[model samples]
Target chain A: MIRRPGDAQFTAFVQDAWRPLYRSAYLLLGEHGAAEDLAQAALTKTYAAWGRVREPDAAYGYARTVLLNEARSLFRRTSWRRELPSDDLPEQTHEPDPSDRPAVLDALRLLPPRQRAVIVLRFYEDLDVERTADTLGCSPGTVKSQTSAALSKLRRLLGDAVLPEGALHD
Target chain B: MTERLSALLHDEALDVPVPAAPAEAIIAGGRRTRVRRRLGAGAVSAAAAAAVAAVCLMPSDGSGLRLAPDPAAASPLDPAGWAVSAGSTLYLGNGATAQLPDKVKSIYYTSAGTVVRTGTVAYTDAPDSAYALVGDDGRVHSLGLALGDRAPSTDPRLPYLAYAQRRGNTGHDAWDVVLRDVRSGDVAVSVPVDGSFTWGGWNAPPVALDGDHVYVGLDDATLDVDWRTGAVSTASHLPAARFPESTSGRVALENRSGQPVRVAEVSTGASVAELSPGGGPGEGPAAVSISPDGRFALLVPWRTCDDDNACVYDQPASEVLQLDGGRSATVDLGDQVGWTPDGRLIRVTGQGVDLCSPVTAVCDPTGIRLGEGPVKVGGNSYES
Candidate 1:
């Protein structure tokens, strides 16, 4: 368990929130080192506002929001670049058989930060367009447009065999 | 797609190892980030910055921006050293020597001096600092307040600095814009404001010291705060735009529209000085502010992913618009230091501080260079 700094409840909170937030950060950033950094940074930001966070359960969401915003800022700045999508497949790994599962990660890396974020929130987080819009600070129109564009890119990268074109509209 | 994605994510989440929770670290980092954000005046305004953000992120080769390691050698800090950040080591300008505190979080270069924020092991951490202003004369005066490191902008001609401060972390989160007389080392006046914009490419500090009066922008409104008296009044009739980074609140710049068109006078919506920006739909311009001399407008056009059909994410470009309404010039900037006192556009690239004069559109061949390799961070100016 992560030892809480000043409060007793925070240790349990961090224990519960760690994996999920790390997972989201991993998906959003598409790399291990950056993902860990992003998750930890988000957690730190949430910790700074622990008093203001209000509800104990909402800490994860707040941390996730900070992570996304920080990721957005990092990407928005020129120092870091998000990986673009590729038509080429990855080099063979030592593992046995491979499905297109690995391609999803690669394909996700290809999407721009904002579009990738929209997909993660809308699909992975199971958020509605309105909620996604609120998270991204864009209108529902932008959310819809980004989702459509991101889906279209994913479809192209993954192909109709794995991701049927008609099915992505949902 | 959603079901498969969910399942795939579940497996992926399980695949990654859960490291021991670093709760103490998180708390420390959080506090530092809060200080940086609050000090930046940009942390609280993510939603606001997003609301007014343009979709332009130019394509870059990522050739120069060094987020990695550069060699350590004993080299005199030059004028270029004033603007670069390599790890925790700040390249003190003009071959000067001063010990930067342990766990420095944010570094703000003001006209009066350079302010260093010290703190711990957070993603970014600092010493418990109100903030320390190291004057050009080599005196470091501790303000003992949580003023954003780079939030204060000083006038080159005068000894006045304008900045903003938020109340305590919780409860009533009231924000105040303040003016400090650098000569007297006193806060001349403090005006209450509704909101503050964060630090990034798109926003500038709203509080500016122009002559005797200070101009500031609140969310959707602009106000002129008197320096002599704490009297604050609305610069009524200015367009509903953010002047987060303008020297004169009398005029504001924003990019909700197509290109980054300048709102001539905030009080009157007569827009002028529209530059021919090289961008598509969401690739409009933002992060716009005027040079200290008022001769040029600096804009960093945002590159949006909305237009990426291939999901091709790339990095690149900075633009300068002539305030006289002439053509704009594009510079290949990797990292930006604020404008020099003489108004030379200084950019730290793979090379060093290339001081480019806007009039000639020519950069000095020889400029200050941070030691070779990747510069960890720092080169952000408070003027921004």
Candidate 2:
């Protein structure tokens, strides 16, 4: 193997960025095995281009972009296609239980790939419309529309007490 | 409610179980990638090595198979010479050549190197079609991509290969315009195409890379995608449905019948020059090719053949039209023609390749010949 001085730096980056990248991947993919595969693929691609990553501080951003791209690729699979959103909501009312995190996760899984991605990038990653659109490789208008659709689905899945109608405005 | 949902989402992400980071695996994969690019250092995969062996063992008389002695240091637009492929051998202009195991289908030029699309057959797109990059050092490195039949585009200044891939496995109309960096073999950007596909008879949409923007040909409109910023906009000035060839600031618009008719400004639909005469059927030329700088256009006229059963349309003649001045000069077209990076004209015949000056229409022989087989020139050779 060709050894470079950047190997140690990349190893350090892997240790630091792995969990956050994995968490983002998990949020986007909504499963452990797919999330792990997506995260590993992103990190592997990041390692391949490590020599071109000029700033060490920007490594996380690069890996995150790659992770999102990998998730987009995963969304093209047959199983992911089966998760496309339909007009009819689930029969059961997803009342917010004491542990509301599970309810939120369930609602997230019901969304289409692009809509789910919009939700994760906006609320979880704290990205605005333009930045989220850039990350998702779409326009700000698309980000806004997908965000609106995903929030509507989430509101219907979870009761109004957990997510009020006013939440749609923001 | 928004804050609560955000907090819950964060908590939900954090609540998931995590596994140990596979540092060794990632590092090893990176090392493999690095090794694959070091073709000059004699590091190649076993499959690529065997393919090289197969190419070397092909029948040749040791005539025009010379390898470029030094790595290319010239600008891509001002290439040292022309490159062409016959059977399995690539004849790099000026006595340098490289042989491949598969037949060369099409060739694309980039600042980093010359990329060739290879398949088992010459003119047919198959499932086994692969791409390889012939570096300036005269070494071929496999890109390891088998993108099925979708047309990919490259610019003379950029090192990225751009193409369109479907966004879903269920055969949806959505697509993502993907750009892969040639040097690193990593996907630099994947911009999702916001529009639906109405373009019939294509596996996916065709892409044309000019400077920073790649033009995707759709049925309703041509999408001007910025590879750097991932911005998608409509190139409303160009032709709406048919594919257009984009260069510096000019686009060659295809007519309703998918034949080249005129060159126009990409910003506005103003005509730069008429590629063909405006009246009557069968008046259009057989093929029209624009220069890399978008300053000149080559129109190869069709000729009548005595034999009906076995006939070809492209004659051994051409009219070189200067788009800026509206003046044209007739030149003798060889078997095939393409443009150099510096906007010079190149013609290839069974005898050899010739460098032609577009202004004077004078052809100068470069003394490159590959015995006997079908020859495909680079630049615009594969254009129809």
Candidate 3:
């Protein structure tokens, strides 16, 4: 059973969750600085609502929900412009060869925000269907359907050379 | 099968050096929230403060708001560090050394757009209006609340810095481009293009301005304009057989013949060199992007799979092509790699499906993956 989060509890919550939250924002926004702003905005909103939240254990989930929602909302309000200037490439001492990565990213960007969110939470976070559905505010069946559709599109855009062994089986 | 795909994607993660200010940023952001609340309370009357507080405290209906953990109580913005997550959240240092502006009014989409800022540094003031520039044909367009009476154009690229003006209408489809002060919205210069550029349409051209030259990349070719003199010149004529799509700073050209072809930068009809694609064009050009330094080109080759019409059931195979001066390398990304803006690291989507099971065959119907890194599946070297 989760208790109501008090001011002290809320402070502790922010301290523990800030790093992961920040990372999530960066992954979604793709810009370090912008990601920081988005994360902060989400955090501020969470702080304001701490008193009303029912399940304190679910606070992280609630905050994550807020962050994802904020990201999607920002995307919607901004009209989904795909191009952005690169301030600096993520610093890599050793440059790996570029393969199908660019194409994959491009295809991912083409997806609608909901579908994209589902994909990110499912794969990157490695969440199961139930958790993914819960996070996305959709049914597990919808998650299954979305995963199917997204993968099918990726396979079609990329070719067999990129496919892993037994990728198209079943 | 899922394991293999996971391994491949795991290999593609770019080992980015963590920024030095993650802890500081979290702490600082937390402190700022507290200070802002106090200041907000003091700045407004009791009634106003209560109203603002009520609005902030209201339970989110979960319509537009997604929930996440709070950071204010837990961490202060640490200097010398930054943090990124798969969930699209990022944290930066909040130390005095951190150079984040006091108030960031707006962020432009690309290098072409300008992020407008307002208010005095170190002191809160009224909200500042920011504008983003979009260019089409040969004229520039401004978007945001600041442009009172002016309309936006269809051009994809806008100058980083520009002046705007409203001139006499050229025709039903024609309009004049005027230079205006960004701060005051007063026109300082004006230029006219041949056609009327409409908004909310597909196949729009991307425009970029460098010094006096305005570069436009259209569906067919790239155009250059002397904004000062109102002269337009064709820099490169794209082959009609190839349909070009421009986004961000990169352009994608697909050949209808299905034969692998390369598009190289040409000067005055002279061929400079062909951009390499790791190996020979295997399945034609799937997608192409030029690096910011103009030294490298990134290519994703087209692939064929069993679930052609269906969604991705298992790991989709795609080839990543790296093109540098004379050498080309192909890195097998058992999956797709998303490119960052600078074109250095490719963000790989980690989600995979178990193709052996009919139930989980197509794991990602949304066709979206979240992760960032560089190409690592096949042995290929990237020039830093």
Best by DockQ: 2
For residue B218, model 3's alpha carbon misses the true position, in angstroms, by: 7.3
Per TM-score, the best of the predicted structures is 2
Write model 1 residue lDDT over A68-114, tens digit each, in one string.
66555444432231112233344445542436444576678777666
Better of 1 and 3 by DockQ: 1
Candidate 1, which CAPRI tier?
A: incorrect
lDDT of 2 by residue, B16-100 (tens): 7889988887777666544533421121111100000000111223232222232223244646635778777887754667777
TM-score of chain A of each: 0.66, 0.73, 0.54
lDDT of 2 by residue, A31-53 (tens): 67657766886887678666656
- Please provide, for model 3 over A53-151, each residue's C-alpha lDDT reduced to its tens digit, 9 standing for 90 to 100: 677687787777667655533442212322221122233455435463445445445554445555566655566887665444334555675666556
Instruction: Please give, for residues B1-384, the per-residue lDDT of candidate 1 as tens digits.
Output: 456655665665577665677777665555554454334212110111112222211222323222112211212222333434443344445444334444444555455555555543211111243456656544556665554323455554444456755644622224566666544557655555443332111123345555445555444344555544445555554322333333433333433322344535433434446544322212234345565555666565432232111111122445566766566666655544446544556666664656677666577644455654334233333221
User: In model 3 chain A, which range of ten residues has the least summed lDDT?
Assistant: A78-87
Would you give the TM-score of chain B in model 3? 0.39
Query: B1-384, model 3: which lDDT tens digit per residue?
Result: 344333333343233222433434444444554453344211100110000000011121223221122201112211112111122111111111111122322222232322232222211112333343322121233344444222222121232233222235432233344434333344433454333222211122334433344444322233444555565555453321112222222233222222223434432322222323222111123334443323344444332222111112111332223333344443333344432223332323454211111111122222223243211210011100
